[model samples]
Target: MIRTPASRRHGFSLVELMVSVVIGLLALLFALRMVGGAEQTRRSALGGSDEMQNGMVALFSLGNDARSAGYGLNDPIIAGCNTQFSDTKGYQLAPATRGTTDVTPLAPVVIEAHGANPDRVTFYAGTSIGGTPTLRLTSDAAAGATQFDVDRIVYGFNQGDVLVVAPEQPGGDCLLVQRSDSDPTATRVTVAADAGMRFNGGTPTATFKGYAARVFDLGPVGSLAFRSWSVADGYLQLQATGPDDASAQPSTVAEDIVSIKAQYGFDTRTGSAFQPQNGLQVNQWSAAMIDADGSGTAGDAADWQHIAAVRLAVVARSKAVERPAAGAACTTTTAQPVVFADAAPVGVAAVPTTVNVAVTGDPVDWRCYRYRAFETVVTLRNAGWRPNP
Candidate 1:
């Protein structure tokens, strides 16, 4: 008989086993909760970064164009109107005249949709370096001549470029034509389309100074960038094309931009010094501040020329929806407007500030979302180049 040593099998009691299993499960649940919290924080940080980046890009694009508004045009005054060439409704392949007038009553900047959820702003600018962008003529250009000779041919000029020939004396001898040549080395460019414009009716004037005739390239026919910025469907959009291009569509510049506010910076001081009579260092900016002729009256189109800078603000929101604490409500108590430090509108009740914008087309509560605001002042370098008439 095998001596069966009583097996000292002290197996765990059922109560002991059950208690141990319960403790293990509790530890696992706690670990999962910690991981979930960390992931939420990461998502929030990433979303915030994206919103800020979008806002910055929007501001940069707008500022770049605003600073160069009057680039190549010799005229110090910038006038906004329906250009003569654009009246036919297409991209301006040729030079155009101001729809409003030859002089005075010009607007380089136009604001639309004021006091609304999304505002629209339009501005005009040239790509030329500065005054005296003309090249001397090498030979005489006959009436309806497809091409003309120029002493200097600059690089970067492409086919479909627009050329302007204006009299140095500021008389009525102006010719606007479109380039049909793609050759960069060629001494002459042909004009396939005139857009019904002529310089002295193709007759060379002895008063005009050049080998044959003096001319200048106002960038490419397609280079005339007529851009419009607006907030639509929760996105900041940019519509850039020839102002006449009805077929052109707007492109998305940035996302989650809900609202925009802007103010025009004006120099209302009457004396030689920069200080205004109001005792302010700079005349406070306002959406309604106007001083076209500095006659003490406001609202004239010429007032736009005095706009030295633009005080702009943009408000962005998160793409994701968040919830309150487990038991907390989804309501938000404070919705503050964006404050502008440089703006001080005169006689106006208040400066136009960005406010809480409503989000639509969603089942989730918008109050649970987060928002960010960005503000900056963009100086118009071209505006300063123009002398006050």
Candidate 2:
């Protein structure tokens, strides 16, 4: 082979070759770093979006149910009665308790507070075509009676309409019955134990009986809503009761919801004695309904009637699992998320409340993820329309 001149050399020496190799390796390393950083940034952005979307869904579901609370059950005579209801298909209303007594009060909204843990909210409403009118019973309805004789002709009630037979007294057990047969021109609405009926069997007639009983129509079974909301297994869920949803299984409303906190907004004045105030404005908020009427029992009808609105807060977490560098500890979540930031007390001075979100019990380390909180105050419109008893 002919020897090439130094200036026109075709091949590089070993030193030049090594230097070229070093430069190529540096360029490759730099490109890899850029790609890695971009991936991390993308993950964070997507995670934040997911968190926000989930939180909004949870807030909307809770607010929607709360808005319709106490629709047909807003009557002062039956609004806060401990309703005795049952479904043959294993459906039962949300179990509420005051002290040691188990009760299920008929209200537009009931909040079961669990300190530091997620709270449970139950909503009740009727979708009757006609307005909620408490029809007087023409005669006494003996225990276990299948038919109810009303003062006026039952025109708007359908065959599957759910009716609540409430005693004239304010604090009594209300019975839920289904209208199996109804004639538009007749005053007798039958709640017979038909095979297709779901809420007529388990409730004993002795559970409700009186000449002063009033019938409140809850519309058709398909339109009746008795839904309860809670956070469980890292998801927001709704447990609804009706003919179609007799299973009573809680369906997931949103994912990554780690906590739910709620409080009852009362329409009372600022004083030692909780005096009723004018208008539908919320004067005070409490985690639980106390014996506002000095009735000796907490969460009684007297306490529930004061509830004018519900303040709800939901917490959501990111799905992305961040990794620590080498042996470093997780620094993604420096502190727990705060909720109800603007929730200062109104009227009187009260202790500020803080909720501790328990997000560490899951299989994966929750510290590697970020969190967001959504809050709303839903007014009970039906409560506003009803005059305080």
Q: Relative to the true structure, how large is the alpha-carbon lDDT of every model?
A: 0.56, 0.78
lDDT tens per residue, model 2, 179-237: 89857898888989898788888646443444577888888887789888888878988
TM agreement with the true structure for every prediction = 0.65, 0.89
For model 1, how does the per-residue alpha-carbon lDDT over 1-389 read when each residue is reduced to its tens digit? Answer: 75644553567778889999999899899998899888778777877787788778777777776666545542421232112232133322222222223321223444553564666766565554334255666766654566677776645555655566544342234455556667788777676544532211333332334464556666654556556677877788776555344334567778888777666767655545532222322355675445633655454433554566666678787765666788877654246545464334434233555565665665666576677777776766655554333
What is the clash tally of candidate 2? Answer: 2
Pick by lDDT: which candidate is best? 2
Model 2 stretches astray by more than 4 angstroms:
1-10, 205-210, 242-246, 269-278, 344-361, 387-389
Alpha-carbon deviation at 270 in model 2, angstroms: 10
Model 1, clash count? 2
